[model samples]
Target: MPPVWDPAEAPVGDVGAALLMVDARIKEIHEPEDESEDGAEAERGELNRLFVASAGAEGVQELLDGTCTLLYMFMQWLRRTHEHGDKDVIEYVVPPLVATLRMMPRSVRPQTVPTMVALVVAAGTQVSPNGWRSQYGDWTPEEMNALEATVFLVAEHINRIAGDHNFAVRMIAETLTRVETDGD
Candidate 1:
């Protein structure tokens, strides 16, 4: 069973403030050791802790919902670029986004699944052009399969949430279409 979050104990405003404080502390902690390998490792650990804490806080689902909205906007941006033949946009964005997605924990991945799927769909569409393909070879078939699987898993989780069924289904379909198109 999932742990019940008590907003009475920690209100959403309090949680947001706590997250901001934690972020500030993390930055301060890492600034001095930015040049050292140990500092880098420590910074990573702090970041992981922050994310876990944020995800566990009361009203985190609301935060996730808001994040999903922002991600959707990013997806629209990607789609618009594709329609305009602006492949150069991805050259500046995809690598970092991909790296971040790859490093995310499976638990967290499910939380952001819709956003990830949207990103994949946008990327697949952009990559369909000959110029895009020449720059970044056809994405590996296995990668698309893995993303599809992830989308389904995330959809299952989102289905369990109270008000997210429609968004989940839409994201799942979008992701599946991209996976199929890329595989072809």
Candidate 2:
């Protein structure tokens, strides 16, 4: 027998209902107790059914919309965290940040560069030896350097995106000028 659906597994919030529905379908198709050979075959059949069902679900559209919104918010958070000199947050968020930067569409690339540059500048400006200690704990200098490399990669991505938009180039230039003048 397939597992019963449970709405509780759905993430609560903007995309919660859709995620929950997907989770319920996944659970129904792959119950923990269904370990037998026959169960495996049944699981495959259930998976196919789930694919078809999900393809037609309004939930999937909601999920996609939610994901895009979350991604934008996450980028904003990263920018703020960097501005606050929160190395701990950067250390924890780097991997996902890099992944998001890499996967974002070219259309959004220009808008994303400033945040990425801000994150790198923030990471480089860490003044407290213990600031990153809580999160990275025992990370070697090499590990920290690797994180810097990721920041550099994001910077390059920003540059690539800026090349595609004249407005982005002007905006970035103006922002850089403001930062430079404000520092004086």
Candidate 3:
């Protein structure tokens, strides 16, 4: 569990190394300390406090902002480092990437959904022209369509949020745009 990105310094590094660092930290965050009930309860309490403390109505927005920034950084890492429309990217990279993206709380869904949309676009390109269901044995059309709709709604919500909070939205949107345009 080495530090992925030092909060003191800006986010800058080798993309592959950064991805590995972020993956490691996510694993560490999710890992169980002890199997005992007491340990589990303690862990839950600590995580809840962290979530709540960041999510408070007053002056605690930085905590939530920091978490969102890190999540966006992970998305930027993947988009900049990985080749789009590659089979291995679809198989190996996307599953864990999606899982990590899911770690962001629902409160930040507006900020995170565009990343998810980017992932879907990348992954969708990898599926067979006939359909993804045939290529990927387990996925159903209904499920995929539902996910598409959900992502669309989330993106719309992001637009709505951006309309109100232009400053924060502009910051994140610009970073995402830069990552998409610039190569590593």
Candidate 4:
């Protein structure tokens, strides 16, 4: 619950490097043939360690933002890649992430919605069973539907936190209007 970083002042290079390191670790964990099947606990531990290490860059706003984005991507990956019914790793990781998000400074908080959407969409596409393109004879209807639903849910949660509760609704309405007018 402590402030992750003070947006006003923090060493940009050091914090950025720390966040990148954590991201690389996350990538390693997700790599095929990299982590052992029985190492789920170890994977979660490593993620936790990275999370804490990133927190040490406290006061660096972008570092915190990058960390949160990476963690969310990790969650989306965890849900898709793992077949285990037991979600102990997710259960262990998300609360702290949520806490970290809530602790973000107002200056950086507005960016959360877009960041969540981007990461969620990226995660969904990468983890899609068939492929990223549902319209290209790749993804099944069910997979497309699931991906859409996941993106919608993540956006809604982010909008709620970012105080833009009607964001998606407004975006849909705007898009519909644009389509109706043929870009006029």
Report how far residue 137 has shifted in candidate 2, in Å.
43
Tell me which of candidates 1 and 4 scores higher on TM-score. Answer: 1
What is the lDDT, from 0 to 100, of the residue 51 in candidate 1?
A: 63
- 1-184: candidate 3 lDDT, tens digit per residue: 1122222232322333222223333334345455554666467458646755675543233332233233344333334434443333334444544554456443334444444445344323431111212233443323322333333232223334346323233445566568778955
Q: Go through the candidates in order and give each one's C-alpha lDDT.
A: 0.40, 0.39, 0.38, 0.40
TM-score for candidate 2, residues paired by index? 0.26
- Candidate 2: tens digits of C-alpha lDDT, residues 1-184: 1111111222222333322333343344345554555666567558646854775545443443332222233334445545577555455455555566556444235344344434343333332112222233443433323332333343333334345322222333465468679999
lDDT of 4 by residue, 1-184 (tens): 1122222221223323333454343344344454447877567668756765675645333443433333344345445433355544334334544454445434234334334344344343333211212223432323322332333344444344446655433443454467669966
lDDT of 2 at 123: 36
Best first by lDDT, ranked: 1, 4, 2, 3
Cα shift from native, residue 154, model 2 (Å): 15
TM-score of each: 0.31, 0.26, 0.31, 0.25
User: Considering summed lDDT, which 10 consecutive residues are worst modelled in model 4?
Assistant: 1-10
Instruction: Give the CA lDDT, 0 to 100, for residue 3 in model 2.
Output: 15
Q: After superposing candidate 4, which stretches have Cα over 4 Å from the reference?
A: 1-131, 134-137, 182-184
CA deviation > 4 Å runs, candidate 1: 1-33, 47-56, 86-115, 122-184
Error of 3 at 61 (Å): 2.1
Query: Which parts of model 2 are misplaced by more than 4 Å?
Result: 1-14, 18-57, 86-184
